[model samples]
Target: MSVTSSDPRIAGARAAPKRGIRFSWSDPLFRAIIWQIVIVGIVVGIGWYLVHNTMQNLAARRIATGFDFLDRVAGIPIGESMIAYDSSVHTYGRALVIGVLNTLQVSVVGIILATIIGTLVGIGRLSSNWLLARLTAFYVEVIRDIPLLLQLLFWYTMLQGLPPPRQAWSIGDTAFLSNRGIKLPLLEWQTAYGFALLGLAAGIAATIWWSRRASRVQEQTGVRPSVWPVAIGGMVVLPLAIWALFGAPLVLDIPALRGFNFQGGGTISPEFSALLIGLVTYTAGFIAEIVRSGIQAVPNGQWEAARALGLRHGVILRQIILPQALRVIIPPMTSQYLNLTKNSSLAVAIGFQDIVSIANTTLNQTGQAIEVIAIIMAVYLTISLSISLFMNWYNARIALVER
Candidate 1:
């Protein structure tokens, strides 16, 4: 008989080798953490270097750094101001506030005018009439190609080239236009006007609430109620009634020619007029293209389907097309608005005295270059972020809800 030996030591020697503590190059989590840490370290190092360099430079130059300069007297005259500002009496902060208001004024008005004109041009670009479509395309091409700064300069020159105050252009006795500026009838305000405004606001809220209720009712009853008549009645008629009841606390102060200029009413300065015109015309071109593309993004079948349902052209456009096209149009339109606001900074070149222009003056006066620039940057950043947030919220509200 052959002797066969199976020993425990032989089995232990045949076992697989044990793995010790080692680095794992293929672990996704570990690699990601390592890369993040490396990037953060580099960024921190760079930031530290910049801060140190800036502090050293400041110290060497003996440049005082702080926002205390804002409280100093601003002995600078502003061309246009929404709030009361005296060059000798107001602080630098107050002057800057006026500038901010002016910027907002131009931006808001420009955006409104641009959207209206752009939407019209966009629709015209797709018109059935060949002439209208060709004309719209020409406008888009010409306006978008020219530089906005050049456009502003040209407009300013044209305005300045107009007749002097003695030979001012008049649209009746209520308004005047000249190289100096445009003068218009202003409404004199009163205490009752505030109440009337409140009433009008309430009417608007009620109209919105009614519209929502109407929509829900229609959904449940398969009948769409006409809300426009009620909306108009509330928005217009109610406000007018309230105004009349409050003794009509509004008086028109018509512009009149005085010694050397038109006075006694509101004035739109040449600088403001030029800046507004340039901003509106330039921004409208891009907005027109955006609107056209948004409308075209809708399938042709949508139009055919609406027609098959016997819907009128206006009804189809308002009820069917725009609601859908707005989804595509809003995002790009928001960008154009932001660009318009930033471009308003170019006002300094033409002496419009916007926030940026005024801040530049402050920097030169106090030699607080860093502080002034930082303030300007912060203001612009805040405005841009606010617009972005609003537009994003609006976009979400109108976006499709797919099941």
Candidate 2:
């Protein structure tokens, strides 16, 4: 039989596809439009309710919300600010800056020290020797189980109960330990100190160059390069050279017995000492676990292959294991860094005068809780974003390209 347009099937197929749109839930675009409309409605409704509630609550509480309080003199005294912070001369904005600096000071130093300790402990936990592995595990478990605030209190109490400065314990006549915290010799700075600082910067740049060169050489030749000499020369020799060139602008500000208290040297307050020690110890325990897991993630086949290539244990770890492990370690490490930075807020408990502490004081003095809390949140958000950006960039650099 021949087909014709007048036939039912033929006519249905040729009828311009019915000239009608059928709505179906299975259509992804339809579902997406529905979702968007629902989400926008919910969000807008919630926002409106919140704003209405906030206005009513503020009126009931007789609370005014604005940023004008930042200009008012923060009459609160910040003990242990980096700069002179009397209740006399600074605005709340200036005091907030000082607090931010203090937070950074503790967090930066704590991160560096924690990384060093954590890496060593992590490596020890992975040791072939039974004794080292057990010891490291014990340390990690013990420190991890305790709350950091409690640890800070313990360290503070212990340090604060030490003998007075007059009878301070001395280590080789260079450092003093007492209830006043550790007193160490500081270099009295002169104009020439700037050159020494430049030298230190140059040394750091040289070290980075050397490390990159060494890594490239190892990758190409399968030969490990010595790092100790370069480390010593850059860290020790270069700084010394710069100091000498600048006629050594450092005068030892030795702590001398003066009447009843020690004089002339830099002192660390008990609050600072306790906070740093606590943060370092607590953060390091978690970092140790991250490092251990990262190291363990490298396949056994990798170790065997490297061994078959006649690589020593150290070479295998450095060239084959650590590079791979770092990729695993870095993402979790970003979280730990962010945690440590935010934990610096706990410094308020000990009167360490970090950003949170100053903000709290400013709030109390100015009755601007909303503004102060907002500022604290903004500062922390900025810090977290910065750290995230840097770590992500570095992580991308080290990440392996997958085919």
The candidate maximizing lDDT is: 1
Q: Pick the candidate with the highest TM-score.
A: 1
Q: lDDT score, residue 321, model 2?
A: 91
Per residue, candidate 2 scores C-alpha lDDT tens digits across 107-131 of 8999999998998899899999999
Per-prediction TM-score:
0.87, 0.82
The TM-score that candidate 1 achieves is 0.87
Instruction: Please list all clashing residue pairs in model 2, or write none if there are none.
Output: none
How does candidate 2 score on lDDT? 0.86
lDDT of 1 at 218: 96
Clash counts for all predictions: 0, 0
Candidate lDDT values, in order: 0.89, 0.86
